[model samples]
Target chain A: MLTSAQLDKPIVDSDLQREIEHFLSYEAHLLDTNQLEAWDSLFTEDGMYWIPLEHGQEDPVGMVSIAYEDAILRDVRIRRLAERHAWSQQPPTISTHQVTNAIVTAHDPTAGTLTVRSRFQVVEWRKRNFLRHLAGGYVHDLIKIGEQWRIKLKRVDLVNCDGVHDNFELFV
Target chain B: MAEADPNWVERLVEPARVHKAVYTDQRVYDLEMERIFGQAWVFVGHESQVKEHGDCWSTMIGKEPVVMTRDSKGDIHVLYNRCPHKGAKLTAEGCTKHKPMFRCPYHAWMFRMDGSLVSVPHRHGYDGTSFDPDDPQFSMTPVARVENYRGFVFCSLSEEGPDLKTFLGGAITSMDNFVDRAPDGEIEVAGGVQRVMQRSNWKIFFENLNDTGHPIATHESSFLAARKTSKHKLGGEVPFQLHIIEGNGEAPEFWESLDLRAFDYGHSFMTAIFHAPKGKISEDYKAALDTAKGKEEADRIVSMNRHNTIIYPSCSPHTGFHQLRVIRPISINRTMVEIFTFNLKGTSEEYWQRTITYSNIVNSPSSTVMVDDVEVYERCQEGMESDGMDWISQHRGEGRDNLLDREIQSEGISEMPIRNQFRAWSHYMLGTPASIPTGGGDS
Candidate 1:
C-alpha cells in the first residue's frame, strides 16, 4: 500500500524517450548551475515539489514532508538563497547530479500527460562543511502544453527519508 | 581537559552572564547531563502515542534509553529499554503496536507490558540457579518517576524531586490552554515526527526559543525573502505561510511591547506576537470551538495566544501552532530536535492541514526560516571555541524584574528568561531545589 504509483509500463518510442531524458537532464543542469529561476519556470502554475518524510506517504496534507512546496514557497526559497544575508548559504552550496535510469511508467496521449521515473545521486559541498552524498529517486508527472513539457508533480524519495538530517538548505 | 572544580561550576553562571566553558567544554556538558537532565522531569512521549494495550514507543531521556508502554489492564509505564540479562535494548527505536509481551532477542526472556517478568527461555536451568523472577532486578526496570500531565508524559530519573506539576510551575497554564483550545477538549500527536540534527549545544536551541533579540538579525534573509515574495507574487497580501516567515520582521518595538514571564524551574513563555489569524479557516475553527465550548470560554481560550512555552531542558510547545519540539542533547556540541505536530480531535480537516503546513514551513530541517537560525547557532558554537571571549551576556534587562506569585515578569526583550534558567541550572548543579517565591512581592 505504501509503494510508489502502480502504473503499467508503456513502450514509448526512442524520440519521445530521448526528449524526456533531455528534459530531465536539463532540469538537473539548471539545479547544478544554480539557475533557480529557470528551474522554477519548469513547473506548472499549481505544480508541487514534494519530498515526503515517510516512505509511500500518500497524503501531503495529512502527513508531514521534508518539503511540500508550491510555487510561492519555491519562490521564497529561491529568493532567500540569493539573499546576501542568507547566512546558511554564506559560501553557497555547489553540487553535481547524476540522473539516470529514465523509464516511462505511464502515458496518456489524450491528456498529453506522462510519468517518468529516474534515479539520482547528488554530491553537494559547501566551503568549511562536510561533503554530503544524497541518493534519491525522482517521480515526475509531466504534462505537455503547446509543445512544451511542464512538471505537474515532482516527487523525490530519499533512501534515508526517515533518518535524522542536518539542514537541507536547497531543493533536493 | 582537566576536571572542573565544583567552585568553577558555581562561578560559571552569574546573575547576568555565563561562562563560555558552559557551552564549549566537555566536562561541563557531562555535568549538565548528570545534574540537569538526570534530575529534572524530562518529556518522554504523549499518551496518545500509546493508546492501545501493549503499544510501545522508544525514546531517550538525556542518554538513558527508555520505553513508554501501555499495559493490558490500561496503564501507562516508562521502563528502561535494556534487558535485565545481557543488557540488550528490548525494543527497536520508534513505535510498535500490539505486542503481547516484550521478548528479549538475546535470551528470549519475556516480560509483561508493565515490565514484570513473565517467563524465561530455559526454565529448568534457572530453577536450580537462584534466579528470582519475582525480583525487580530480573525484569525491565522502570524509571524513578513518571507522570502524565493532561496526556503529555514526562519522567524523572531521580527518586526525589518536585512532582511534574510543581516542577512545571506557572507554565501549566500554557499546557492547559493547549488542550482547551481543542474543540473536543482533547488533542493527539499525529502526522509524523521530523528530526533535525543540530551542530550546536542543546542550550543554544533552548535559549533561542525565548531569546527575542536574535530573530531580527539572525532571520533577516528568510524574512526579507518572505516580504519580497509577498510583494512580488501576491500584490502585497501576505498569505498565512508568508506571514509566519515575515513575522520576524516586525519592528523591534513590537517585540519589546509584548510580555515575558519566567517561572522558577527554567520555564518561561512570551506572549503571542502573531495574533489569532483572521481568515475563513480560523473563523470556521472558532465556530467549531464556540459550538463545543461556550462562546465566552472559547474566546478566552483563543485569547491566551503564546509564541513558545519552554518547559525547560526538554521540550518547547507552541500552543498556537499545535507543535511540540523535543530536545535531545547528543553531546557537548551536538543536539537533535524532534518536531511533532498535533491534531485537535474535533477540528475540521482544513484546520489540521494548516498545522501540517506550519510544521513544514517553520520547523522542518529544510525550512528556509530555520536554516538561518540553525546556521547562526552553529556559528555561535564555532565562534565560542576561540579563547577571545570568556562570557555570554544575559544582562539585557537585569534589575527590572517584577516578581509575581511564582514567576518573574519582564519586558519582552529582556534576558530574564535566560537568567531564570541559569538560576535553576545553578540550583540543580549545586544540588539544591529551585526556590520559588511564595508571595506576590519580592521575598
Candidate 2:
C-alpha cells in the first residue's frame, strides 16, 4: 500500500537522465570552480544535504550522521572557504571530481523528482604532500523546474565514511 | 634517554602554565601515563555498549588496554586486556562472546566475564608448582575501581581516592540531565562513532571545550563560509548551518551574559548561547515531553540547556544531543576524539533525528564547522614549539570570578575555566594533598 508518507520510486527516462547529468555536472562545476554563489542555487528554500555516518543510517535524529547540512551550514562552509584567512587553504586544495556510474534508479512522478546514484572519486591535491582519496557514492534527489532541475537533497557516501578525514571543505 | 629524570615530574607543572615540553616532550608523556592515566577515573565505554552478556569494547586508559564488558549477571566489568600467562591480548576490538567467557589467542587461558581466571591448559603439569587459579596474580586483573554514573561507565586504577560521584562534583548535572531530558528517563548508546585525529595535545582539545574567545578568530573562516553559502544558496535566508556560524559571531556582550561554571576536579559546563529555542525541533520535543511528563517538568528539563560539559581529561558530553566526545591522548603530539551519539528512550522519531542532525553537522570529523577549529588548535600546537614564546595567556577576565561555594562562575569570555583546570592539573602533577574529595557533590 502506497501511504501518503511513502515516497514514490523515481522514474529515470532518457531526457530525465540527460537533465540529471546536466544538473550534476553543473553542481560539480560550481564546487570545483569555487563558485559557491551559484552552487547555492541548487537547493530549495528548506532543502537538506546529508551524508550518512554508516551505509544505511535510518534516522538522522537518534543516530549520528557524518554530515548534515541545512542551508545555513552549507553557506558557512562556502563563506569560510572564500575567506582570505582560510589558512588550511593557503595552498588551495586543487581537485577534479570524476563523477561516473550515473544510473537513474527510481523516479517519483508525483513529487516531480528522481533518485540517481553515481560512483565518484574526488582526488584532491593539497599542500604538496599527497593526493587524498574521496571515493564515494552520490545519491541525488533532483526536482524539475521550468526547463531545468534543482537538487532537493544530495547524500554522499564516502568509501572511508568513518575514517579520520582531514577536512572536507568542498561539497562531495 | 638516560632512564628518565626522577625530578622531571616536580619541574613539569606550575600554578599558571606548564612548559610546552610537557606537551611535546616524550619523557613527560611517559610520566603522565603513570601519574594521570594510571591513576585517574578514566572513562570506559557506556553501559549500553555492552548490553548483551558478551558484548565488549576495547579502550585505553593512558597506556593500558582495558576491555569493558557486561557479565552474565548483568554487571559491567573493566579488566586489563591481558592474559595471566605468556602475556597475550585476550580479545580483539569489537569482539563478541558466545556466553561470557574470553579466551586468550596465544596460550589457551580462559577468563570469566568478571575477569577471573577460569582455565589453564597445563593445570595438571603445574599442580605440583605454586600455581593457583584463585590467586590474584594468575587471574585476569580487573581495574581497581569501576563505577557507572547514569549509563556511562568510568574506571580508575587507583585503590585510594574519592568515589566516582564525589569526583564528578557539580558538573554531574550535565550527565544527569542528559538522561533526564529523555522522556523515559533513560538513554541508549545508538548510532555509530566518528573518530577524528587531531595533531595537537589532548589538553588543547580540553581547553577548547570551554574556550569562548577562539570561535570568532579561529572558526571565522568555516562559519563565514557557511554564512556565505547559506545566504547565496537560500537567498539570504539562513538555517541551522548559518545559525551555527552566526553563533560564533555573537557580540561580546552576548557571550559575557552567559555563565561559565568551573567545578571541583577540573569539570565544568558553559551556559548555552543558543540551546533551547522556539524552533520546530524544540517545539516538537517539548510536545513529546508534555505527553510523557507534565508541562512543568518538561519545561524544567529543556531549560537546563548547555553547550559542552568537560568531564576532566577524558570526554565532553553534550547534554542536548545525547552525545559524548571521548578524548584519547595517543601521543604527546597526537590525540584522537571519538563521538558517540545516544537515543533518548521513549522519545518520538523527531527527537532522535535532532540528535543525529547535530552529530552529523557539528561533531563529525569532516564537519565543515569543526575543520577550521581543528586547524587552529594544530596551529597553536605548532606555534608553541618555537623558542619565541613561553606562556599561553589565561589572564582573560581572571580576577573577576564569582566564587559560590565549590562552583566558580565567570563570564563566558573569561579564561577562569582554563586557570581552574590548571589548578587541578598542578594538584595532579605535584601530587599535593593527594585525595579526591569525598561525598556526593563538591559544594
Query: TM-scores of all models?
Result: 0.97, 0.85
Record all residue pairs in model 1 with backbone atoms less than 3 Å apart, i.e. clashing. none
lDDT tens string, model 1, B1-443? 23555487877888899998989998888888888889999999999999999899999998899999999998899999999999999999899999969999998999999999999986898777878999999999999999999999999999989999999989999999999989998999999999999999999998999999988998999999999999999999988889889999899998899899989789999998665568888999999999999999999999999999999989999999999999999999999999989999889888999999999999998899999888889999999988898889899999898888888899989998888888888888887558655445433
Candidate 2 CAPRI level: acceptable
DockQ of each: 0.88, 0.47
Runs in model 2 with CA error above 4 Å?
A1-31, A36-49, A56-62, A70-72, A99-118, A128-131, A139-153, B1-8, B94-99, B103-109, B117-139, B225-241, B287-299, B434-443
Please, what are the lDDT tens digits per residue for candidate 1 over residues A1-172? 1124453343688899999999999999999999999999999999999999998888988989999999999999999999999998988999999999998888888999999999999888987658999998999999999999999999999998998998888878
Model 1 spans with C-alpha error above 4 angstroms: A1-10, B1-4, B436-443
Candidate 2 lDDT over residue span B126-195, tens digit each = 9789998889999888999999998889999889777889888898899888888887778887778888
DockQ of the two-chain complex in candidate 2? 0.47
